[model samples]
Target: MKTYRYLDLITALFVVVLIVSNVASTKVVLLGPFTFDGGTILFPLAYIFGDVLTEVYGYKRSRRVIWTGFFLLMLAALTFGLVNLLPTPADPQSQGTAQAFSTILGLVPRIVLGSLVAYWVGEFVNSFILAKLKIATQGRWLWVRTIGSTLVGQGLDTGIFLLIAFYGVWDNSLLWTVFVSNYVFKVGVEVLFTPVTYAVVGFLKRREGEDYYDRDTDFNPFALGR
Candidate 1:
């Protein structure tokens, strides 16, 4: 029953990033030589937030935030699907914007399922591993836990999401290429942002007087009881 000044703010930011990432995933874009879904640019920041959450607050709090994200994502996908299903009014000259709405906001069932599943799994894994590493390292070497957890978490996330979202829909070689690109890029972001992560974690730990250790935490993704 502990409270932190910034936990709510952090969780809100995490949810916002996740929702935006989903919205942006509709377009495959080329950035320089790399071709990736638009989400690829914004998606990795969720992991950075994930690291910050677990690192500062511990696994149990992070688990609640992860489940919060999962529920919100599911609700978003559900709402988008229902909205897309509504009938568009008929007009002879109407360049129907309904179709455009559908194209933009409609959820692909497979991709939605993949995204929710991958996000739930990957975030929990990231939180759990970071919590464990915090204890193992005796709370030293913040970079190790952040980057190490991202390496594993983002790997699972990118691979599982791409496989489910694009395996049959995309060319085989392109699928693997995108998978590799996504994974490498996500992990790379964690490395590049390590200093930022350290600064945030340090500030939160000091301000909130909570550098929690999850030694006795349940680590259950489904159990959100507080």
Candidate 2:
């Protein structure tokens, strides 16, 4: 296996974003017209990280990073769940803390499963689309690839996650509102960060001497290959 100067760093950051997003998702918030989980603000960055990883390191490397995040997130969820199940101290000062902790970090099986499935599917779709577009366009326009892939990826991500996580628990209207709002917000983040993405992609390519195109690469998400 070959190593790059910053691939590890980028992968670390990517996993951090994913784990934090999962933890933050416990809160539902309304920001103006948008009703979404607190994670909405941070989850978009995970997609951006996906774009950069696929663009600079190729889909193979990005796939590995995605799996890394997946397993780590599952581990985090399990850890939280176990901690939430433990009996609290009997002291007066800590009496209510257990309930608060459970309220915030207690794992809901449906939500955790939904998040994992949605992320797995959505990220692969995003990486696959961007890689294909890069080849088709001969790498002419970065914005087209980034924004276009995100439009589709985030749509499936937002819809699947919300439906699975909230279908029975939330009213139909609320579900639709969240799906639309989250989709728009995520795509908006991609568009807003296009310039920054360009800068980072260009810098990484030059410095790391890698601008991977998946012309001969495997698209299998399970194949962690070199």
Candidate 3:
């Protein structure tokens, strides 16, 4: 019912970053023998922001933001599909470029599906846990809620996304490796950023004059009406 001037804008930006990072995440480059997917670097921030949204704004508001992101991703996937389906120019060079675009964009469906599912589950878990912890601790120990929620939320997110996106494509061992690596990387990012999270949460609470408890809020992920 209520809207903040910058909430929608922030949600839009988060969604755009999520989509771009997912697309760019295909490559795992070595940083002096320490290898990591490029996406792993930026992807955890989305969760951090997600936690902030839910912790400060409540589940209803966070739900709207998450659904907005899901729809935006679907729109992006549809556009990619349409572009790939359209006929390329007669020039061989143009055709090659078109094919390359298709190769990159064609993976959108699986990636988007996995993303939507993982995001929905993981974010809700983070928020639900944070809200409960906030009440239980009477809003004390902010770091505990943030890091504790992330440990659970990021674990589910990494596992679900990898399993849904790459389960059968890679060998079992490789799949497990990716699962472990991504999970550790994401959770590590959350732990490292805990200080930043505390600062942001403090600032938002002070500025917004709101520290939502979600005492009477619904936790249903499918109830978009909230």
Using TM-score, give the best candidate's number: 2
For residues 52-135, write the lDDT of model 2, one tens digit per residue: 999999999999999999999999999998998888889876868887888899969999999999999999999999999999
Model 2: runs farther than 4 Å from truth? none
Top-down lDDT ranking: 2, 1, 3
Against the true structure, what is each candidate's TM-score? 0.96, 0.97, 0.91
TM-score computed on alpha carbons, candidate 2? 0.97
- The CA lDDT of each predicted structure is 0.88, 0.92, 0.79
On TM-score, the stronger of 1 and 3 is: 1
| Candidate 1, superposed: residue stretches over 4 Å from native | 92-95
Model with the higher lDDT, candidate 2 or 3: 2
Point out the higher-scoring one by TM-score: 1 or 2.
Answer: 2
Candidate 2 clashes between residue pairs 3 or more apart in a chain or in different chains:
none
State how far residue 47 of model 3 sits from its true place (Å).
0.6
Per-residue lDDT tens digits of candidate 3, residues 177-210? 6767777778888889989988887788777777
Q: Summing lDDT over every window of 10 consecutive residues in candidate 1, give the lowest-scoring window.
A: 87-96
